[model samples]
Target: MAALSISLSAQNVTGLQGEAKNNLLRLTWVDSVDARGPVYIYRSVSPFEPGTDLSILGRLIKVPYGVQSYIDEVEFPGTWYYFVAASDTEGQRFELPLPPDNSIGIEILESSDRLAVSPAAPPAEIAHGGEPGVNSLSAAVEGDSVIVTFRAEDRGRAVVLYRSARPLKQARDLVGAVIVQPDIASPFIDYPVPGIPYYYAVIFEDDLTRGTAALYPGRNATVEAVEVPQGSDGVGLSSSASIRSLPLPMISLAAAVPGMNAFDETPSPVELSPEASKALEDLEPVQRKSSLAKSPRAFSQDLEAPGGGEEYALYSIMQDFFLKKDWDGCRNALAGYLGLPRSSASEARARFYLGQCYYFLGQPRESLFEFLSAQPAYPDESAEWIQASLAALVK
Candidate 1:
């Protein structure tokens, strides 16, 4: 008899099972104990019946024979069937089904499902950046300046501070107001002439750019203006712009009759003085033609008074510009008025209006200077303007 040979192979895969969750299909199988090579995993829209071509398309993966489970990421919701066939060291595939094993099917949805055990979780999150805006804002009068104190959370960026005669309510209040400090820090010293009260507000420069910050009274802003002492430097103020950069008005109540408070005196309007008309005519050729050429009657204002000479006419011109809120034109008209002969009353009015022009123009230093010079004529009124100019200079 010729010699006969017989070789043994590994058992087929068993216990094939699947669990679907969150668009993921997890397949599990019992690795054949005798298996030595990789196993072939097949998937299809239909169940795997016996005699189905084991070599046909539908092979999902070839897992090592020792591995027992795999998680398949599903892109769409639907039904799927799976089969796991074990292999021997000879690389030959075993049967797809041998018992209640090696074959399974299930339906999946876009939503998630949980089993007795779950998958590993995702990574944790981390935070970045500091808090925005200002806080703890308060003010006190120190020397000739009001020391404004506050806590700010700035990430090495700039901030803007605003001063207002009225309580600050919105960003719109910033209109026509000088930026007391383009960049700011706490304990800012402000030079405010004693008289009018003032409110302050600070905003982060970054928030202003990002449009996220807001003005909140008593939080980042002063709910009330600080009561500055009767004595202040009356010379200059402080801010991120520097306390010294802004000079407050130095008041001089010179050449005034005793107790003749100008603040209470409301003079009646008069016709434009001939000197004022002549002065307007003398304006440089480049001055605004139609607006500047108007007659005194055409440019009447509340503060006009009867007077004579070039100074009086110049004063009239200043009044016209001032009433129009044309600070630039008013300031220009003042240069001519300042150059003329100084009259006790005429000079007082000029100084007062000049200060008004500078204050409106955002030049606190010059505004304060003129206000102080006019103190003698418009005692009470000049004091108020001076105090306001001083507050504007505050850091």
Candidate 2:
């Protein structure tokens, strides 16, 4: 008998993807033939920090070799980041670069309480392939829908189309655009809010899997705001029927994605403010906080109301701090607010305020993170803040 020798070089799962349907989170990836055995999956609230052990995420799943997809029954509805890596026969795993490679993130919305959170069967299957490289991407008005046509480097790969009010600069701009179709065939036809112009961008499943699908605006990524004439869109369907029959969004331009960049998920590294630079002269990077609060702020509105609960109570405390312009107090309260087991209607408000606190206190970088996190809950309300925070950080 001979021993199996596996090379421990840099390897990654190409085409990693995640989609949220109701309460189900489906993840799928390409299994490179070079893999030795099992695969490891990890999830986190924020982007996965480099070099951190997978176990620390507190939710690690190991799928046996040959399994290309897994469905997770998620408990809460909020933002979730995920990454997958192939493991060796003995379970040795190598660290791969985050997002755009073996990593993808999606924000889940609260589903009906009666609708069980049990994982549904794996999604139709991640149709992945094609060169992923794209060219001649353009948008044209088609009756009631906008037809986004582009030449894919190769065909058969699933594409994610985005609609934005402004031109997208890169794939990162995706956070600011509405995902018209997460997994669809090319020549994407979208039923957007009638009467407004939009830009569109197309990204491939293969690019997402290989982390090479980074957006290049006109060259590769960025497009949105598909304005169509106000009238009938689908075949033999009235305007109202067209809006209701399609699974794609028919939301107002402002609702689809706030002002301009409310959901800019990944911003460049933030430079320390002069005062912050001095304050961090020797401080170690453990975790940043403002200060501790004595108690949860009293709830406003009726306690028996649908929106009133522990989540609301905690949010109130943060609001009180925000009202007094107490950035640190608000930040400290946010520490507890985010720990709640489930998300609430106030989820967007809480994050929006925290984003403001960071922005007013000269922490635009942190502000961007909070605003982006808040998008799933309150898509239309936070873009202005995202724009301001981004402008500040960029300067």
Candidate 3:
């Protein structure tokens, strides 16, 4: 016999959170029949949108013939809309009637603080003591040696410069050049190499008066390079190409947000072996990037045992990845652990990690999938965190 998918009521989907409340999204539904199935509660930033286009956002399994209310705790504080549906083991889907006109309610609330957004590209400006117009800058390339110079104001601090072989958007490729200090109206020079085109920008910095013992750049802008001299030699004002000065547009920030202090700066009083120091140095910046890139490899490298013998190793690796903000890697490693044919304890641990990974990756829907799958494998006490992560995903 073909299985019957659970159809739900309109009231089950209506009367939900209508504002951003920093609370879980409450969902209720009535199963048509007593069927053991995976009931999914889907949410969207927009109303009545399909699962894929709009983020699936959240997912949950409705218990058979029980009080079918699920609290999704993963929603951010914003105007959010949602929909609900259920599916049977046969993969047959039955969608609940959507709210009137297909829009879920929202109660707006506040979200917690997070990491700062990365810095953007800089613009062009006049050098200190120069005329009111923008400075004239150019790129001179000569056989593996490229000299880039620009005239900009000495804005009371060192002139911070950035050079990129590619366009300005690829921040990973942007390397920090020397900072030309304030009160200096000198031409800035950087070597980028010949034949390779490049983009450049300079920023002027000022002491951060708001924070104690801190310095901040007052303004940043980009300028057009006026000259690109091919095979230009060193020494003397080699003025071959005529250049023009153009002021880079200024960007604005809405508000001053608190900056994050890096954990690596937490000085450890203990001495370190030469090998440990080298290893730590190697893992510093590259740790985060490598974790993101090699999540699968890290996952495969973890060892598991017949009992909980391998739990420590797994936890250690996951902890390392989590600290590095390699959430996807954590999720993949957990998923790999879950796929292994192992005891229930190991599976529970894996599932817990899976939930954490999903939460950090901003995929509450998939995170929900992992949480519910692992819920039964864990004890009641341990499952609390599992449920918490699940609840977070649905909201």
The residue pairs in collision within model 1 are 144-232, 144-233, 235-248, 237-243, 238-243, 238-395, 239-395, 249-368, 276-313
* Candidate 3 residue lDDT tens string, 139-176: 45443344445555444454435555443321122222
lDDT of 2 by residue, 1-395 (tens): 12322232235566777766777878888775667678888876445545756664566788887788999876454445677888767767756634555776655544343332221121122221222367557677777777777877667776767678876765455556665666666677777777667887777754443334455443344333446775656543464665543577554533554454545653435568999988888777798785433222222531233466765575466447765778788787876776675456566667766677777778876766677677667655555566565456435
Candidate closest to the true structure, highest TM-score:
2
**Which of the two candidates, 1 or 2, achieves a greater TM-score against the reference?**
2
Candidate 2 similarity to native, TM-score: 0.29
C-alpha lDDT (0 to 100) for residue 326 of candidate 2: 85
Ranking by lDDT: 1, 2, 3
lDDT of 2: 0.61
**Candidate 1 residue-wise lDDT, 1-395, digit = tens:** 12221122236666667776676778887777777678888765445666777564535588886678888875443345577778888987776454246676555532346522222111111111222357668787775578888887653777677777777655445544556776777778777656668888887755543334556554577765776665344543333334353659755343243544456453434468999999999987785544222111212333556466755586477557876778798888877877867668767777777778787777876776676667756667676665666566662
Q: Please give the TM-score that candidate 3 achieves against the real structure.
A: 0.24
lDDT of model 1 at residue 163?
76
- TM-score for each predicted model, relative to the true structure: 0.28, 0.29, 0.24
**Model 1 segments more than 4 A misplaced:** 1-132, 236-395
